[model samples]
Target: MPKSKRNKQVTLSKTKKKGREHKEAVVNTMKQAIENHNSVYVFSFENMRNLKFKEFREKLKSTSRFFLGSNKVMQVCLGRSADDEIRPGLHKVSKLLRGDAGLLCTNLPKEEVERLFNEYEEYDFARTGSSVTEKVELKEGPLEQFTHEMEPFLRKQGMPVRLNKGVVELISDFVVCEEGKPLSPEAARILRLLGIQMATFRLCLICRWSPDDFELYIEGPDDSDIESA
Candidate 1:
């Protein structure tokens, strides 16, 4: 009932809420990354503003398994700031949570990650859909085809791009398509042709739990050697 006691109680409650289910997720992440010895998956977010935000979010959801984690929980388990330790785990999630923000952890392939990203290729819905108004920096890799097809649409947004050194850069920033114009029928068709890479491999989670300091793992046994002995 004392004032100091009451304040301490409140602080504890806040800390509990901030950490929440995050402790459980962090423990599981460490297990997967360190124990199971799975490849750490990181993502990159270029234009996640209001531009077709729902569509963009769905793209992420479909491609990777994301968990909402607390920074305190992550730091305690990671043995460092999430911004640093998590970079090796997830590229895009860390950027979104540079401060006391939410973090998404997963173990998916790089190709599938990009595949899910491009799946929303038609968010704008039309010929110009391939070309969006947002600032999209196309990095070098197998995604050049999609970027090459999107050149015209990028031009419309006043961004001229030409692949140099195997990478494409936007001369200007990308903007959301303005209000009041459904993508032309031709544009929509072009988007379909451009199509999403369509991820084939499903990200199978081997385990999910808590206790950040520890890790998880999986293994198979061979009967041949044992049987011979």
Candidate 2:
């Protein structure tokens, strides 16, 4: 065989092996977490923010463990069929592990989990390619938040901005973003500059699996509610 062909085959083999190892590790970690915690909860998330989620994990570190990985791997760990089920009723919970979801194994009481989830939320600037939930318009007046030095940068972001005496002012009323429209890179940047936050970091509980039974926990929010938030 040619040298190049042999090297290519070796690379492919290594990549496949690495992937299998990762899947196995995820399964093992999930199994251990389940063994250690009292119960498991499957939760969905929106507008995921890494830093904010890190803060949440820190808060729950003492009482819980979080596992976010491939849904298929999680399902495999919990077992999809009755014959090789991980636990008595975990297969039912496994079926709910779809989409942007993950496992939360905790020793805390269910009531506390519900209360914490209810109060958990983080707001941040929307990113480019994200649909704008609300209209953002800059009026033709002095922008008190920005100084004259920032006028050039704001104008570079396609805003009709100028320096007026030591303040940044909009030369005309400009629509930074429109509802339901995907935000452009410039628009997203301008929105951040204007401090118009349009993305929410939130976790939604989908179901819970206890030793005795399985229960669907929370209903998802309506589309309008998500958009208007």
Candidate 3:
């Protein structure tokens, strides 16, 4: 065989092997993300840009939750063959994810997924997607029940609500910070306090644990996760 041809065959084999390995890793991550989850909240940051994306990531950082990897990477992390409709439908969300955009795979109890991303999104960061850019649905439980808990967080987060398309809705909008950086230290205090205060005032997501559960998660949300501050 010619030297160039031999090299080409070797390169091709390596590329194919790498692709398989990447897919397997994605499948595994997806599996690990749902190992103990009650619900799997799949949200796509498809149209996110600029400070909006940074701030969105910062919010997750503050909570010690992060999502990284491209759509292809994530696809491979989650086994592509587990379910038929899921991966393709999820890919549609993943496709919207360009540049720094990503999917958040969490195991913080499926019951708490909506409350994490959408509930407090308006104030924590800007939003660019619409029902068209991204889709929303509850795979389990009553999505409506979460609305009551979510509404108050919206109020505190400084997001605007509109009767978009004849339906009352809390929609995303731009919020530019004063210096084009994250909230100031003072502001961070206020945000944490605001979230905690809102949690207390509304009793939202404030499930009372027994002594054992309390000890298990004694650190609280800010402590439990890697927070921005």
Q: Comparing 2 and 3 by lDDT, which wins?
A: 2
Which digits, one per residue and each the tens of the lDDT, describe model 1 over residues 3-104?
776455434454435364756766667545544433433222332334454544566564334433355554455444335553343322222233323333
- Whole-model lDDT values for every prediction: 0.39, 0.85, 0.38
Q: Which consecutive 10 residues in model 3 have the weakest lDDT in total?
A: 197-206
Q: Model 2, residue 201: what's the lDDT?
A: 92
C-alpha TM-scores of all predictions: 0.28, 0.84, 0.29
Residue lDDT tens for model 3, 55-174 = 655665433334456655654443334253243233223323334434454434434544654454332322222122112121322223234545455445454543433443545532
Model 1, residue 212: C-alpha shift (Å): 22
Q: Best lDDT goes to which candidate?
A: 2
Rank by TM-score (best first): 2, 3, 1
**Over 4 Å off, model 2:** 1-18, 218-229
Poorest 10 consecutive residues by lDDT, candidate 1: 211-220
**186 in model 1: Cα distance from truth in Å?**
31
Q: Model 1, residue 19: displacement in angstroms? A: 5.2
Candidate 2, poorest ten consecutive residues by summed lDDT: 220-229
Instruction: Give me the runs in candidate 1 sitting further than 4 Å from their true place.
Output: 1-30, 33-37, 44-64, 81-108, 118-229
Superposed Cα deviation of residue 136, candidate 1 (Å): 22
